[model samples]
Target: MNQGVQGPADTGVPAARGRPAAPPAPSRPDGGDAGPDTDRERAADPGTVRGEHTHSERPLPRPRPAVQRSSVRGQVLDALRTALVAGELAPGEVYSAPALGERFGVSATPVREAMQQLALEGAVEVVPNRGFRVVERDARELAELAEVRALIEVPVMLRLARTVPADRWRELRPLAEATVRAAASGCRAAYAESDRAFHRAVLAQGGNDQLVRIADDLHRRAQWPLVGGPARQRRAELVADAAEHTALLDALAARDLEVVRALVGEHFAGSV
Candidate 1:
């Protein structure tokens, strides 16, 4: 026993003298010694792992709400159509999807989709590898559209003038006033939409859905800017045109067929 057992001084260990021994240095997986600088680096880096079960201190990124693609496409389409009606998108000009998308603060995909819808409406045509070209429409084509509309709508309006009550026609006064306000704003697109609303209200009184649909389509075509036509229509002219809605409403309330026919004919003629 005396040969095998050693005293504290003979053992040569720090713990044997009642003092704690130094801990072993950490090592990397590759067996390299991890110094004080390595521990400091790991502590400084929020993304770095420390112990066996500890994770990074970095927070995850917040999730974003997704935007609806269809809503974006529809908005692009509406904006393009308004631009066309306002004559900002000139007839016979080619507009690339990338260029339009940049202008609208959107990606090219929605612009392309909107352009495709315009092509289907005959407002634009697809150009191979180029873009879409706005369809050039002449004064004659616009005149024809107006004439067809007059043919369909004048008779119905005249009929409504005879049968519809005065209160019903009075109810359309607000719609007519809306057109006036839109015209005063000097926005062609707004006036065009309000004008159509007034006409649609008038035609709705006739209770002919098919007739209204055809007339509405023709009215939209007639509103498009004509090639070689005035770049900007005079505000006075728009106001004058808008005033006719009120006059027609008055005539219908009074059941004055003669005045209604004259106003209706003159309105269509002025459209060309």
Candidate 2:
């Protein structure tokens, strides 16, 4: 239901949560939900700020910029990816350009641009005379990705554990808490981005930019499939994940890479 979604199959990073918001598009500055500031401002200004100052000074929150129509292509990519991760778009499903073009309300040009990108990302296969076909991911591939993740990630995590001060996660706790809030509220897209943030924060402590980049790619390719469901469907899972953040913090506090590896192995192994 993401705003203005003309197509059903999406490709970028998408959300399979509730319908897209009606007027105030869910996507705004800082991703979504500027939160309490907007609702509270009206009480302070009482609509007078509009006359006294430019609308920018009005007590109510300044309006978010209208995302350009060109950005629609990226939005389309994100929506499609969300649906695919959520399993709404099954493997082997072949989407035609004309069909997708009609769905996004753009011509086939954008759809073609977006689909080609997805295909390059290994999320889909391009066929002759057909549009992008969903990649048929199986248990073996999932298991392989998990193994690769462990191999590529454990050393980087260990380096961070050994070299960085454990208190770094304290600096990261706010983002983790925000992600948890997103999960609790059933905001799939927000939660996904949050999850990505938490992992990167930990890797940042490792101090190796190259390692961080590799770890990121592994996380995205392997982790997306595990958390695509509505947070409620995996309520217990999300709860455990939140606790795992604390566990990681504890390990970092002690500079214990062994514990980090064990925790990571347990987490990813369970997912596979």
The collision pairs in model 2 are: 6-103, 7-103, 10-80, 10-81, 11-80, 11-81, 12-77, 12-78, 14-82
Candidate 2 lDDT, 75-128, residue by residue in tens = 887777766655666677799878877876778876777788788777888888
lDDT of 1 at 141: 86
Q: Tens digit of lDDT per residue, candidate 1, span 1-272?
A: 35545442354543545665546666665556766587787677765553533322234576643367888999999899889998999999999999999999999999999999888778999999999999999977877887788889888999999999999999999999999999899888999999998999999998888888878878887888999777567888899999999999999999999999999999998963
Name model 1 segments beyond 4 Å from true: 1-67
Q: Any runs in candidate 2 off by more than 4 Å, and if so which?
A: 1-70, 186-189, 224-233
Best model number under lDDT: 1
For candidate 2, the TM-score is: 0.65
| TM-scores for all predictions | 0.73, 0.65
Residue 263 of model 1 has an lDDT of 98
Error in Å for residue 105 of model 1: 1.7
